[model samples]
Target: MSTFQRFRESWLRPILFFGNNLLSLIGGALTSASAFVLIGFYLVDAFGHGGSRNPYLGIILGFFLPALFLLGLLLIPLGILARHAALRRAGKIPSVYPRINLADPLFRHGIEVVLLATFVNFVLLGTATYRGVAYMDTKDFCGATCHVMAPEGTAYPVFAHSGVPCVGCHVGSGVGGYIHAKVNGTRQLIDVLRNRYPAPILTNDLLPSASQTCLNCHRADAWIGDKIRISTTFDDDEKNTRTRSLILLHVGGRDLTGKLSGIHGAHLGHIVYISTDTRHQIIHYVAKTEADGSVVEYTDTNLKQARVGVQRAMDCTDCHNRVAHSFDTPEKAVDRSMLAGAISPELPFIHKESIALLKASYGSPEQARTQIAASLKRFYQSNYPDLWQKDQPRIAEAASRLAVLWSQNVFPFMKVTWGTYPNNLGHNDYPGCSRCHDGSHNSASGQSISSDCSVCHNVLTIDDSNRSQLADLGVQ
Candidate 1:
């Protein structure tokens, strides 16, 4: 017989001894594959950095790669059992098909081929796993995924630590957080694929108890001292004059006993800033006596929530809600940019044109540029033909500024527009202070929160500049 036949009769013929044990060997190999994949994924997820930044990726790969390996492992035993049964009727022992032994010249190369292929597969899979983990860790994944959240990625650099991931605050610290965000993200993916996502894209559910997530680092008692409030303002496009306001809010905090106090002057060391889940708008608040031994919850009926039971505790996210995402209303952006001299102020009704141009509908950035250029040319030709004729260079500059504004603010390529994540810090954005103070809702302390502008910030002017000269622009 050939050398292969001799080897089969010797070492390979021992298959009869392991005829019933075939399943065990195959099962063990599959187990090894699964163990490798799971152990690999765990290292990648728990200790790796990539997946931490891109939450969506962690949602996809953190759970999927391990699952695939597990499924493959599970099938191995079933395959072995089926093969053994199939061969028993033929009086042949179950064994590794087309068995190759190193002593046999022709089949010896097959063993090396198997080893080499397995090695490459492992190396590549390991690299992919590491990359996936690192991608999940990136801030880009947190703020930019779902595409609608570009506003968040665009703004995170403006706030405090630029490198902090979204999960550091939103999901906080817990293994449960890791699982919850990923599972919810899967459902969100299905929705996005089916085009069934609700407007505003509500997906986060089973939010971890705020106690574990929010207060772990930001203990209420840790904050102390009065805070200086900085404010900015905008004016209507007509006259292009300033309509500024300022605030010196009494943001008092932790006192001698290390308890945060003076929250809206309630004398409660513990304050619960409550709001509607509608838009994360502050609706009403609850406060317990830091030492009074009474606990109560304050709700705002005026809050635009349809169903209740969505109350959350006050934390960094409660007030500093827009830390990662901020979109300036077009009027505000143009007004500030013009004031900053990035866009020439006298660029032929540029402020008005810029705001209008930004608000215009377009399919994409390229389309927006084309439409805005045509619209602006027509505007100057109709409204200020003489001025446009005189200051053509300034007009060009204004068009360029407006084009940049549209590109950054309106990314139609991703189906992203403006105002995706609205902040409820101020009364105008969502509900904010008005949720409680607007001549509606019940107060827990029987004390009133004011709707008057002066209550929080001094409004120097009103519908007209003459309002500033009026007699009754008084203090709160």
Candidate 2:
């Protein structure tokens, strides 16, 4: 026989033998095909003109393809082992191990196939691992996959740190963090599938250590200085009188002199508190570790219950809980729409009417949208028939804006509405700063958590009818 003929028989004979078994043949074919296809797609997506900008590319390359590749790879081994066990039981082979002869044609072919398969398996394994990890790190995997996270997914894009990844804050650094997140994610997935997740998803358990997450971007010691804030509001009056508040916020940071001052500094390294509730809204005990390393404990006079074992150190999130995924109240939402000219301020009682309509309960988002538009239109027609008839376009535009605002802030399916999640940034809307600094928590020495308004910000002007303050500041 020619050397070529001998090599062909040696190399190709055993591969054909393996293909005789339907299960093994199918599994092997699937495994090899999936690996090659995934590698090709990934290469194209990574280097192509569209790049990663296409959302579906990530879903395919990171999630679906990798999953199929892993599944096929696993099935290949199982099918081969099953086929071996069956042959042994049926007396086709004396034992599970086939006779090995280096010079034999079958043995040579088997060895070649094994080497090639091993290399293929190794490459596929690496690809699967890479894609799996990348998929889990995506925002879509976290927010879009689960219906419960729909509200967060919708709000995330408009948040201050919209560009920041969800995992950046939720998942910590290191192997332990990755494992923990995966395990938690699995549990959440199961909960979602089983329809067992809580309404208005509570994040207390999932909240990562702020020191590890928040501090990655914001340095507690960095000098922030004072921030100028101007709040504009309009009354329910005919003129839709614009009122403005000019305030200088004392956002001082750790100075060169080693003094911690202002909003961030006040609690960054000095404050710790214990809350009696799950939401951490009711703070009863507080301990301030002064710069001298002395600790002063404070207790709420009205809190008759004993302290819980849990004590949380004050962090950026404690105050800025809604920094991301913030839900605005009807009043604030209307004010913003009016300020942006989305909702016509020229309409009589537009602000008041919008607020009233938004506050009224509805069954679903669709119903809310329809009702909001109908309600607003009805108000204008009933109250000011002539105006509503003359300015139909303006009324329709205002109604459309109000409907969008309602949809953004409220999710009836999730049982999330305006004010559902308390924003701990300020005291006006929620008992945010007042939770600890309500002038109620008193130390043993009779010292209270400072409720002084000027400690954090100076009231330059508040609800000024005249635009004089704004004019002087060149803001109007």
Candidate 3:
């Protein structure tokens, strides 16, 4: 007889006897199906370049299929056990269990098949695990899947560091960091499933140090001496008079003479501070380590208690917190749009109308878009019929641009309206530099943190002539 026939009659028949019950048979089918599906997914992912392009498809193949495969694996053994117990209770237990004889070729062939199957399973499991982790690391997996992160996710794509992976800043490098990030992600997933996630979710407190993430791209001592910034504003008048402000920003770093200079250099030394609030907007104390290792402590005189909050070392993100996900104020947005000629300055009271339209409340984004455009058209058509007749298209275009600004910055669903998250870069809008530099923080020796106007920037002219200094510099 053939070795296969011998095996089927002897070893295989005995082994199959236990799994002949309905539950075991069902489990066998499920296991077979799941294994085949998993293998198919792996093959397609391996050869299909980047696998499924859709985020939902990636979630299914990466997470759901593997879970089903595991479920099937567990059910197989459980079904076999239950069947054996039922047979035993009915007094149908076998007189002898299946015997193994290594001397027989049938036993040897069956052993070989089991070993090969095990190896294949290991390969599949390893690949699936690797691919699953890789998929989770992607930006789409992080931002697109989570509803609570909508505000940041929407702003991220249009920002400066859009190309950088979310994990690149959020997670530390190496295996430990990867495992930590996964554990945190799993906790977040649980929160999302339970609908317990907070609206306008706060920034994570346990972020990796800026040295490990930010310094990889930005140099600490790189010099960028002085930068001239021109800001234009239109007055709320019949003529919509334009005025420009030219400021020379001291954005310097370390010079060739090894002297630290400018804004960057002043902040490059070892420094620490205490923030009373979660968002770090209220600075209570500041301490700077001098060159000789002397620490100068500067406590806010306005604060009653000196050490009442979270103490943290100073870093690049302390000021540039919203670099990757900045939401502009309505005034800033209008200024940029007008400067780009997206909203015509020639249109009467376009600045005032745009700001009012943007700041007004609406139930939804669609409503905001519709009402903003309609309101602008109505105002122009009623107040300035002559201008409206000549600049109908201009009014429509300006309204559309305003609508876009509102959509980009405001999300009613997430309760993320204007100024929900403050940018700490400037002192005008938020308590940015003034948090510590408002002439309030003083040392024991009566010296206070300088809040001089010229410390960071020198204003060349405020509300100067209509002619731009940029045009004079041949940079129109």
The TM-score measured for candidate 3 stands at 0.85
Return the number of clashes found in candidate 2.
Answer: 0
Q: List the candidates' TM-scores in order.
A: 0.69, 0.86, 0.85
Per-prediction RMSD in angstroms? 7.8, 4.4, 4.5
lDDT per residue as tens, model 1, 156-216:
6767746566666556467877777768766766777797766554333344554666566
Cα lDDT, model 2, residue 146: 58
Q: What ranges in model 3 sit over 4 Å off?
A: 1-31, 38-51, 74-96, 99-120, 465-471
TM-score between candidate 2 and the true structure: 0.86
Candidate 3 lDDT tens digits, 1-476:
89976876665555556766677666556656766788877677779764477877778777877666666666766777787788889998777555556679997896687567657766766777777889888888887777677778788998889998888888877788778878988998899889887676776467777887788888988989999888877777766777778889999998888889988999888989988888888888899998889989999998878487677988888888887888988988898889889999998888888888999998877898899989998999899999889999888899889888888888877789899899988888789999989998999998998999898999876787434555776644
Candidate 3's C-alpha lDDT? 0.81
**Candidate 1 TM-score, true structure as reference:** 0.69
Top model by lDDT, which number? 3
The order of the candidates by TM-score, greatest first, is 2, 3, 1
